[model samples]
Target: MGIITGGTRQGHEPELTGVVIRSSAGHLLVAVDGTIWRCQMRGRLKRGKRQSQTVAVVGDRVRIGAQDPHAEPPRGVLEEVLPRTNRISRMAARRTGGHVEQVLMANLDQVVAVQSIAEPRPQTGFVDRLLVAAERFGVAGVLVLNKADLPEPADQKTMWDYFVSMGYKVLRTSAETGQGGPQLADLLKDRVSLLIGASGVGKSSLLNLVEPGLRLRVGEVTGKTGLGRHTTTSTELFPLAGGGFIADSPGIRGFDPWAIAPRDVRDYFPDFAEPQQACRFRTCLHRDEPVCGVKEAVAKGRIPRWRLAAYLSLLGDLEERAERLGPRKRP
Candidate 1:
């Protein structure tokens, strides 16, 4: 190994291997084997996205060039972002938000959506939306009903049964009682899974139970907001001794429908194809279209209105965004 370097050396880059664990304080913490390197955005990375959120996000595998550790504030140069096998993204929620995707996590084998059984009850709409995104990314998604020590209400049970019928892997876990711990552990083996859910649903707690070594900080669920305090702080990939990685993401309150194309939205729903194709208009949004198969199905109770509603809502957002942006002019 060469002696310590001083400044950015593009000619002889000090490439570091890492998978982005977290993005916080405008710097990303990248992990190699065990050690995590704090890196700053390189000029190239900054220039890459002229108008958007800062540098690398969690889950990006990258080649970073190290800077002087002796510097007052250590900073490393991010060199290149490796191609991702699959990534979870949401509609970009910012000024620079066009059709640009705000990638949440990259290259995950599965996503476990943790929802509470009571207190702040589970939202099936949100769950379906996540399922749609998972299907779109070709990643497996499991529904985790946390706080199982608490009783499951009628609505919660209904939601649980619905997803169960649809073939979604559902887990009823109690962070306090250690319920579903073994099953969760088994599913996690040899897979890079992403744990996502609304704030204050015991994500950190469940994770702690899974890996006592992690000991991640748990946040108090504020009654006023029905949300969990910022606990994870940053998104980071943590290793499991059994052989896998899990990204403990920061509190996610509301998932917005941004940047996705309208035509492609139906494909994500999974339950839409067979029936939706029979829609009167080939492009029928199933909204106000006459004799729409989807609308009829909803009337006959063949399909749930809530699911169709989700498709319509996302479809509307995409259409509205398209109108707002208008057609990009070719100079």
Candidate 2:
């Protein structure tokens, strides 16, 4: 789609071009130049398919007609949604144990999957899945290991090295000590990046360190559960001091790949891409297959054992979900 500057339109009604910065319920906050407008989607746009919870999200460029030109808090009606380059989404649960795609943000450049080494311990599975999702959506992915001052488990350290060896950019950060903030800032400069991770992993803390003005509310890990209390209720995009934008989304404990088949999961892992070509069967699922290049790589110490285990675990989850749904269409 062609880009248009603000206050430019072709019709009779006065429409201002803006980007959706935040959406809650049926109201959206659109930013035009230095002004912010509260808007509601046009009637026709509200009839979007029910597969997604909302039709518009943060980072969507839109055309809006002013509801009141002189109101204290400006009001407008969202007239049109411009084309999006790409989006990041997750599989939200359905009543029948099925999954629906939930778009978290649109037009993002990269996903920074944050994890903590100590409190609210890191789950490699979650990080890996986010990277896979990033790959599926054609977005760059970065692994941020937060709370670097805390002691890390031996396995996790090895896994970190493995990810680096596999060509994934990994950063060790400590929001408390400001370690690795400059490096992360350099990478995030002038880019629209999404910061996502499990609760209490310091996604907010890290943002605060990078841009002190953000002052995003942060919660501590509960003593009993060792999980963080949800601090950010919804996803919202914020501008960084240096440059670019970062969307701080609510902490997510569980994430299932949306509309993905078990066989497609292996292709998302970079280590499996080249080796799987040598497998005897073209459609090998890499599980219990007689001549599997992936399995062979695992046995030969080429691919990390824990990563393969994580992949299998996700595959089993998908299989169980498919079984639950019985006969359903695959995208």
Candidate 3:
């Protein structure tokens, strides 16, 4: 039990139920039922230890307490965070290098992978990488192919068919055309969906189209790079007019598996999920191992070659890291 530090004289304020909408500038905006509040993390609570430095993020259900709880203007401290069902995090920025964490959002039901059709052409490797992370965490992964109104471009029908065939849902939307908004909205109607993708993918633009009332700041594409300027710097959970909630985070051009082990990376690919067990060696890394089914599948056109290349790339990275950190020497 927590004893109130007596910031109020009359009586200790009661804790109210809330969900963190955003955490930034040392303040957390928690939506309490129909209302909202600006909250701070107490210094004392920041003590003891942290499972991670990122205690609060968008979509975290929390308990709030404030001596003065104004309806329109509210302020308080985040007394506690309810347990999360599942979270979406990336390779947190690190210094010493074992691993560090920067959780982008919490309690995510799905991730809408937004891949722009143009500006900065979609990156297959990046999509696969994020999907791999989602699979490891058991979070549902969906794909959103945006910017479909551009001039003749590469990867139109071919790419869409690939993921759809893989049993993953894909929404082809054009913010300018209002193409797939309704379908996409219906998909996100009652679930916690987080939008993720490259910088120039029109993530914010698509959100605006999904709900014109949102009016989020949208940045123009860089003339030289043909990529989007970063307009969103933090993660925010928005309540959709239809139903469920959506959390928008900073653009992720590339996703490293965070702290995910290399030996376990193969299990992430949906195609590899079943066939992986067929490898000759139970511990096969799926690269050069004898009778590796995954690699063979790629050769026979069962798996996309690009995906195999990505898996091997990550596998090599982890193998190299293990070697470098092999048995630290005694000082």
Least accurate 10 contiguous residues by lDDT in model 3: 1-10
lDDT of 1 by residue, 20-137 (tens): 8777755777775566677877765665543334456677787778676455444566787778787777766645545455677887899888899875777657887788788877
Predicted candidate 3 versus true structure: per-residue lDDT over 197-246, tens digit per residue: 87878889888888778898888779898778888998888888898888
lDDT of 2 at 88: 83
Off by over 4 Å in 3: 1-11, 48-51, 94-98, 151-156, 320-331
Q: Is candidate 1 or candidate 3 better by lDDT?
A: 3
User: lDDT per prediction?
Assistant: 0.75, 0.84, 0.77
Which of the two, 2 or 3, has more lDDT?
2
Over 21-81, each residue of candidate 2 has an lDDT whose tens digit, in order, gives: 8888878988787688889878887775576667788888888888785886689998887
Model 2: how far is 64 from its true place, Å? 1.8
Candidate whose TM-score is highest: 2
Prediction 2 global C-alpha lDDT: 0.84
Q: Cα deviation of 102 in candidate 3 (Å)?
A: 1.5
By TM-score, how accurate is candidate 1?
A: 0.87
Q: Candidate 2: where are CA atoms >4 Å away?
A: 1-12, 322-328
